[model samples]
Target: MTARWGNACDIVVFGGTGDLAMRKLLPALYYLHRDRHLHPQTRILALARARHEPEAYRRLVRRHVSQHVASADFSEDSWGSFSARLDYMPLDISQRLEFARLARHLGDSPGRVRVFYLATLPDLFAPTALHLHGAGLVDDQARIVLEKPLGESLATARRVNDQIGSVFDESRVFRIDHFLGKEAVQNLLALRFGNALFEPLWRNGHIDHVQISVLETVGVENRGAYYDQAGAMRDMVQNHLLQLLCLVAMEAPVHFEPEAVRNEKLKILEALRPITGMDVQDQTVRGQYSRGRRAGETLPAYYFEKSVDHDSNTETYVALRAEIDNWRWAGVPFYLRTGKSLAQRKSEIVIQFKSVPHRLFPGTTPEGNRLVIRLQPDESISLSLMAKSPGRGMALQEVELDLHFDEAFKRRRWDAYERLLLDVIEGDATLFMRRDEIEAAWRWVDPIIGGWQEVYRSPKRYAAGSWGPEAADSLLERAGHAWFDERGD
Candidate 1:
């Protein structure tokens, strides 16, 4: 399946019949095909447990592809050419013999890259990797992609890693944290390192506080089976939020390579002050969303989902006051929260600067600038600064120096999937999480989760459309701060 498309070969997508494939993967591949990004003979072989011929898979894909792809220039000729590269193989991880067909289909294409994408559940990752090795699909240059919710805890994550490590070297594994592929997230690094102005103010003395939030307006759609076992802490904050913390808090590395950048991120993770013992209650807020409105529609609570336990202690919303115990960010507090069924969907980092030393006029407004890096709903950066209200009097107010993606960049913005997929093809691991980085994140995050089980009897309940539990606001209220909104940016 390897193609002459500039040295890359077939992208062997496992769980190709899953949600991610139907919505994001195939559509992206279609666009890549339409734009001539793929090589002349490049192929995309989809593997799944369903019994289907290549033609049947093509039909199934055609229906979804037509729906997800917009009206533009997908001609019959283009689809025919793209469909010619479409292939499928039925697979069940538990059955060893089933993988033999997969292996035979992938015949020896020396130097042809084989990209294995694991979109299935975590439990299936190890078995699939071993089966790949057993089927002789593991090569020195082959690549394997691992999706997140890495594991329930550090121990389980390590166990999964050990299982996968047995078959493939660390270099061959690509751990995707789609957040990193976000344009603004990547741009944050560029802003900090590329600009001479920001780095000087990036330290403790000049900065007052940092806030990171990744909220969702939608409820757990059809993931109740998985959501019940893992709450907001493990499902989102542990991997995604912690990684964002690393990116924002990590010291700049000399080089931007995978290991170099991750090394600095690991240091920031290691420098994270542990939140175990008694202080857990003071520093963290955990809650579950009850029924409420979202995106102009009513939504149910976490327990309302089918198959969810009535007495579940799993949290749907979480807010924490984390501190990095390093010279660069000694006293600055990094507040992070993520939840489902909230007021609005927003993923942003707000840097609230310290107030000016002295104020000359009694009635004059005080000045404080905040740098907001937003990820979703929109991808942009805005610096909130003080401006004089237009009048005869010297009244002060806030104005923004904004870099909205639409106004700033005219090119078609790439989705997180596209950037991450390209990174996989080009072997760029800067945006991908590495072994130690994942382990370290879990190491720091596991204790916070474990602490709640021992101390907090139950998760505080917030309305589905509410902005998490009332307790979440208290985490910052005592520090004289509040969460950012669309207008606040």
Candidate 2:
């Protein structure tokens, strides 16, 4: 690993011995290597600050790969091939001179893709990029991949973007939101823009409201320290939740290309009416989770976690309503909610259409059309519409017209990492978040965060295993809307 192994390589993971490295990046690269999606001569070089030989590093990767890969896809050959492509480089990214080894290893590989994957902390990004630039490692053909919680606020986020932009061109920088790579998420673009059936009706005139909920089954767990610093706003709402909203509210792209799709998303981001001052409490709710049962096992409160602050007011849950002031969605509301504990893990978009002008079946029961798209654990799309109740009378009943991606596709689809890794290798920034998109999200979100600080001064408390605080439910209930639970659970 110390000496140059080969010429061509697609990805170079910097924090290769870290959690994201073993848990996601390495295993993902294995799948690409197996499928021959990666170039034959391509290499996977792992760079970490620790001094570890090739075999030790391979053992580190193999241990994680073995645990993460599905049992069905597990194979000795897969491990052998993937491990063969591994190389290790030990250097402190913070040291400008230390990147010389990386530069030497990457010398004139010509036309081959080179991605500097930053699995490290946000503070290290600028220094790493500067060091890479200093070593002449960043060239026209090279790209850098950045992971999230870009910054705590819009100002900090802008600073990061500015610092990176100083060294690398906009095109060479790839900021990722993994949710964008999820099959169902990308399928959402196709489900709407690619289909004529849905595009015409994708507006305030036809659709009523949209619910984007990201729920987790577990609490902060090992992430307590990081969660306290980030909270739900920075951790999930700023990136994951906003990305989902963009996909839902964006106008139809002219073509499905990067610019076209991103242009539409940018419009949605720009059109987001700010939530601040008087609107903060009316439109948003922040809460912290207390001790409660996770899965029949009792869990500690956030304060009890190893590195957490006992008196922290950081929210474990955040729910808010946003609107695009543009004509297409002028009055339609988009509700965004995310929280840990008290929810079976679920991420879905519930499109609840307006009730009919009049209830023709007044004395009986009546309902409007609705559609639900579930992304995690399973991928499915179902349209809720009224249908006959099977007796002789026209007793109306709501039935779902369903299409489950799993049940129908019948293929053991690759995980999000697999697809994203392929995209990185193939030089497709289609699903990656662009700079404007990142800043735009922070711009819309920063105000609500500030308003929360100025107003409530602290988050409402809700027990673990419960659906957030009463304020959360009231946020929607006042608008005559309710949250949707996991389908059929």
* lDDT winner: 1
Q: Cα deviation of 134 in candidate 1 (Å)?
A: 0.7
CA lDDT, every model vs. true structure? 0.86, 0.84
What would the per-residue lDDT of candidate 2 be over residues 272-292, giving only the tens digit for each residue?
Answer: 999989899889998988888
Candidate 1: give the clashing pairs. Answer: none
Which 10 consecutive positions of candidate 2 have the poorest summed lDDT? 1-10
**Cα TM-score of candidate 1:** 0.95
lDDT by residue for model 1 (1-489), tens: 233246657798988899989888888788777776677777799988899988989999988888877766457777888899989988887887778888778887878877888888888899999988888888887889999888789999999999999998998899998899889999999999999989998989989999999999887788888888888888899889999988998888988888899899889989999999878899999998887875578888788887788878888888999999989999999999999888888999888888787886556547578999999889999998877788777777889999999888987677787778767876778888888888988999888888887998598999998888889888999998887764321
| Residue 124 lDDT (model 1) | 89
Sequence-dependent TM-score of model 2: 0.95
Candidate 1 positional error at 162, Å: 0.9
